[model samples]
Target: MPPPPPSVAGGGRCILSFAALRDRCFSHRFLAAGLRPLAVQLPVGGREDPHTTVHMWVPASPPRNPLLLLHGFGASATWQWYPYLRPLIAAGFDPIVPDLLFFGNSCTRLPDRSDIFQARSIKAAMDAIGVTRFGLVGVSYGGFVGYRMAEMYPDAVEKVAMVCAGVCLEEKDLAEGLFPVAGVEEAAALLVPRRPDEVRRLVRLTFVRPPLIMPSCFLWDYIKVMGSDHMLEKTELLYALISGRQLSTLPKLSQKTLIVWGEQDKVFPMELAHRLKRHLEGNSRLVVINNAGHAVNLEKPQEVCKSIIEFFQEPAYEASNEEKV
Candidate 1:
């Protein structure tokens, strides 16, 4: 809870990072929903990633039917996962929401930024928390990490739900005009916005209908608080993500999978969702939310939450290769 970064302190004006206060409010809501904050140290990471700190919002009581919620690349999980926490808890699943490395209170001295590494970090944190097996749901960037977790630790990961993750994307997709952005540099800039306009552009791309008015001051406050830290590391993560990725190389998960997408998603597009379904293991199913864009979870929280709950409640998919709104 400090003033905005130096970038926003010009003109001798006083500005505070409102995002901190917002996070505090979210924390209280989480506490009210029977969850508390816990920071776990990751020592399993080799020399470069020693003692990486991963902060998690976990159940105060022992978790029953635990579900790990991984957030997107930009904001903290507290902001993104706040809406679903109460509902998930009420549905008899302990929602273990964790801030991915470089977001919120999670950080590391390590240079590694691959989704595989991120998956490993989160797994180590789960191990420390005494969770042997759990369901996992990841959104956007978190979906990528969740996929890796399911692939790497099939025994520990019972099921997976991914929101707007471009799992079918290949390195050549960008060059072949798959995304609105020309290339990785532009993609990274919007994903990790530094300027107010970049933040607006990101919103426009992520949402089907963005807010009518977003003040410059507030956007600057958001950048300083939510996006100013570990910028280089985050950019590197994007590059590392798309470097040599291909559908053939991407491992299909053995666990049951749920792929959710915004019907009007500009970020990953609906085409990718169908492609993911056709290519991923036959046990997977896809759900498309109408009138929603890339940020489907935020725009269609109730629908997304309902789908997740129903999917997890069942032991296995009743039908395979399904796509429903």
Candidate 2:
């Protein structure tokens, strides 16, 4: 086999950074789709002493009903939501894709790592950008934040679409064999992988059928670019998610909720999706995409986007009638 492509020289060393090239390509895609990058600084507790900065992709002229796309634990907003933007735009929706705190350029100096904090920060970002009433589509960890946004500000959040988010997961779910991993620590390690093997494990768990022979160098490069940042804080966020909450105690959201799950998701299984639907009582709809796993949006973007557009476009009265039926 031939040697790898020429390494890009940076910081006085040769580095093969596919992620850097991918990020440039993602940015170009966003530009081509008519979305511009915007960064806003949100005050903590309405004070400027310490603030959180959020990075987002916004339209030049906002649409009447804006949609916010929140990314999961893996790559940033661009990599996760770029595929859905054009479809949403064509369907008469303005989509704002924001990198959740610690994912892209978004970060907070505050000690809080819960989804509540993330929700508030995102809300502040939207408010800064003059988006008061908008819909939300969140996948995986982002679904957790989107759920909190809907719960905390029901009127402000119009419609919610969650993809493979285990918001109803309790601390006990680990020992009960709900997840492929044994416990929180193991789960964290896999989710925030620092090694090539761990990245492979994550890929296996995330997709129904991942690449069978991912090169070790490629995995290492991915971890170096994507998985290296905010490692400690991300682990804290995971712990905080389950530490103070239980499925029974989770609040029932009032907004019309759409839960999209991969049929073969091992991370947050189909059982969780059904339970989430029932948990939301009469306010939720569940869509299970066949032959997909945790990263359904990436694996089956067309199906996921179609379900989202249909759900969001359905009239309120018709939705109510369907629910009744």
Candidate 3:
């Protein structure tokens, strides 16, 4: 899982390079390289007049079933899916990528409590946009939110997919060995990388098998978009959220669930996926993408997307034939 060498795929700016700290500027440029931007409003604590700002990316499609994309900790909705938005649109799914409150361009201020509260705002956003009963896709921390959604509103979520989800783990099991705690700067520092090299190292640590390398530019951009302070705050908040929680409840989720993980994923490792599968009931499946790492979506979006389409399509298509009678 060592850092990957730089890769340029016919673009204005090359991928972020970790060659030198001075090349960090490219990170900013990379973050701004999106096709479209969306502005959304979510009511704050049940009030209509005052709403929190959430940035989004809505794909152009013929209004197929909605797909809610949730990002990992310290990531905005856009960054989680990144360059994959355009391709998803081309495939017939309406991808709704939203900044989950505190991360990215949404609200920078910490929510004062937990991301659990942010889920309510997400539901509000869905209601505002006239979307209900859609597929849910969450990565890392966002995966937890997806789990909560499926658990709370079984009827509203048609399918649930978790990619490299952040699990409630023992303190000793983490890379940093300390659970993030809000208001504690040190713990936050441990979770995020301040330098480009550190970012590469982190990516390596999380992705173990396929030798997937995060171009230094990717790390550089990641670090710049998520400044040190913001990274720390998110880390603290996330740590507090799952520090002592039990993850056993998630497997009991009734929605058609798919636990997708990269075989080489160092973060939530493939073994964890196996552990999770044991707890899950109903129509649930575990898929391991070969030669991929923790950032499975980024490393292999098409493969992941294909699995998603097939997984969701089967049940609905079967039901339609049944109704034809």
Give the candidate number with the greatest TM-score.
1
lDDT of 1 by residue, 1-325 (tens): 1111223333432366567788688889999998889988887425334458999999888787899999987778878888898788888899999999988889888778899999999999998899989999989899999999999999999999989999889878888888888788888887888887888788888887777666677777777767798889889989999888888888778888888999999989888888888876577888889999998888888999999999999876654756557
Question: Candidate 3: where are CA atoms >4 Å away?
Answer: 1-36, 49-51, 59-62, 108-110, 168-191, 207-222, 226-229, 248-251, 316-325
Error of 2 at 198 (Å): 0.4
Instruction: Give each model's clash number.
Output: 0, 0, 8
The lDDT per prediction is: 0.84, 0.82, 0.61
**Residue 121 lDDT, candidate 2, scale 0-100:** 89
Clashing pairs in 1: none
Model 2's number of clashes is 0
Q: What TM-score do all the candidates reach, one by one? A: 0.92, 0.92, 0.74
Candidate 2 per-residue C-alpha lDDT over 230-311 given as tens digits, one digit per residue, 9 for 90 to 100: 9898888888887756887899999988888889998999889878877887778877888988878888889999999988
In candidate 2, which residue pairs clash?
none
C-alpha RMSD for every candidate: 4.0, 4.9, 7.1
Lowest lDDT 10-mer window, candidate 3? Answer: 316-325
